[model samples]
Target: MQTWLVQHQKLLSQQLAQGRLAHAILLAGVAGAGKLSLANWLVQVVLCRQVQKNNDQGILSPCNSCKACRLYHQGSYPDFLSVTSDSKNIGVDDIRRISAFVETTAHLGKNKIVLLPMAEKMTTAAANALLKTLEEPGLSCVLILVSDDLDMLLPTITSRCRLYDIRPLSGQALLESLNRGQTQENLFANVSQLPELTDEQVHEQFRQFTARLLDFIIKRQNRGALLALLNENTYAFRWLEYMLVTMARSQYNWLSWSALRVKLVTAEGKSAATGAAPGDAIGQLPDSETIWQIYQLVVGCIKQLKSMVQVNAAYLSEKLLVDIETRLDK
Candidate 1:
């Protein structure tokens, strides 16, 4: 678990040592990037009783075996406050309750930690109420907000906090985690248990998947398209996520190489407005300002969909695709 969080830990420890820690931190990441886990670790570090007081720099480290760590693991830490979702939106009253709690001193650690998970889900009124607390954070108070949907958060709230963008564990790291005690042969055997799928079959499945996803996006324009895609199954959701990530990566690559004006003509004969197919002008990619905007929008939609904050996945998908096509003049 610590392996996935080593980078964040290092930065946080540096801050604690220098006594330059921000009163509030905003963690932005895709879902499953372990933002909540990092927040929990941070709370433990700030609240651990056995942490050395003499070493200002050393105080950053949390003794995982200490009583404080144990209590935190058990979810009974008195000083650590966590506000999470029970429903769609966090109400103004919730923020008020937190404000009331923050007025008191810590019962355990030297610091008071308030964690707001899915902070973007807080309603407009709730966010406004929290803004007051942010303006005047009490002594020893640390505000940590976890939001996968950074777009939904008010700009004022974001500007007040230092932002950390968390990312997924690399493939090698994931495999190592999954195969800790297992041999390579054993891992291969486990993989081999699944039937092999041919490339064509896989591509066909993906094509149909993309079609159904588009159907969902354009349901208002084409309602019947979503019926076959949605029998209360999770596959539709999973594929949408996969395609969004894939498209985002593709767009990023295009943008990165835009200085060359490299033209990449897909085998499908789709050409850019200038008649340069995707691969036609390999050394002359155009300016990427327009592509970057589309990329951000697509990523925002993905984050909203994953958090279940946006109800119209199909509609958003259709709009995004149309925008992309229009940008390319396809």
Candidate 2:
């Protein structure tokens, strides 16, 4: 129930109240937009046998006393399915399993819900495997897709979903709300990675990669930071862009505007987007030719994968690695 997401909850709850919610929902936004939180909230509301509305706002919330709510809270809800992955991509097998689960009847005789926190991380095969399920998600099955980047998902997937764009409050509004209800520091770090907003462990993992990349680029001192691994990550290209922005900010002493949209201004100053001189830290950097090639390789790979043709995802990732290595890791 983050402040910025309260309106979304109310809007979704009102839809549920009217029995007009879609079978498949896509909550699309930036990292700090609370996509997963909103998904979880919607799932709880759907699963609650006795949903209660707040007196002040009329927004519905789960009645935790009911058997269904109890089971869900215990993490043993038979009707709830969350597709997850340990590796960089969710493979075809994972989608097949979920598709089978979707076909089954709900154990509670109520609605079933499937949560895909990183829908965009599904491999090309996995996404294709999921098309049948997405196209025909019955009334009993409520599939909730949470994606920070819609561009990474297949068009068929995005087209089938009832989309909701979850945007955050900004400027004075965000600052005032946060100031009024500030809690722990970790809860509001103002960083923008989807994993960073939801899970601390994953956030740490991403930052570790960022640190290693900084070492590789800034110090030429690598601690096992490989561009090949970025090929496997769904957010690889975005992460590269994020790193460069950070580098640029540090180099020029910019005010550190976040791509995630949590704006902050400190040490007030002006920064022009000017390239550094030859042999300068920022000038010898960027290496536009190499970065552009990397960008092109990624765009090509994504285009091939998200389309209908059954291209080999593994082959694409491998090709990306090969194309970037000679150019990137010098």
lDDT of 1 by residue, 59-90 (tens): 35577678778888888877778988776689
Q: Relative to the unseen true structure, what is the C-alpha lDDT of residue 155 in candidate 1, on a scale of 0 to 100?
A: 95
Q: How much is the lDDT of residue 216 in candidate 2?
A: 52
What's the TM-score of each model vs. the native? 0.56, 0.67
Candidate lDDT scores, in order, read 0.61, 0.68
Runs in model 1 with CA error above 4 Å?
2-4, 52-61, 65-67, 169-238, 241-330
CA displacement after TM-score superposition, residue 298 of candidate 1 (Å):
10
TM-score of 1: 0.56
Which residue runs does candidate 2 get wrong by more than 4 Å? 123-125, 135-139, 170-177, 180-211, 223-239, 246-330
Q: Can you write out model 2's per-residue Cα lDDT over 205-315, one digit (the tens) per residue?
A: 555555455445434544234455454555555555555555455445453223211221111321111222222232234454555665666667667766634466667
Candidate 2 lands at a TM-score of: 0.67
lDDT of 2 at 139: 52
List the lowest-lDDT window of 10 residues for candidate 1: 189-198
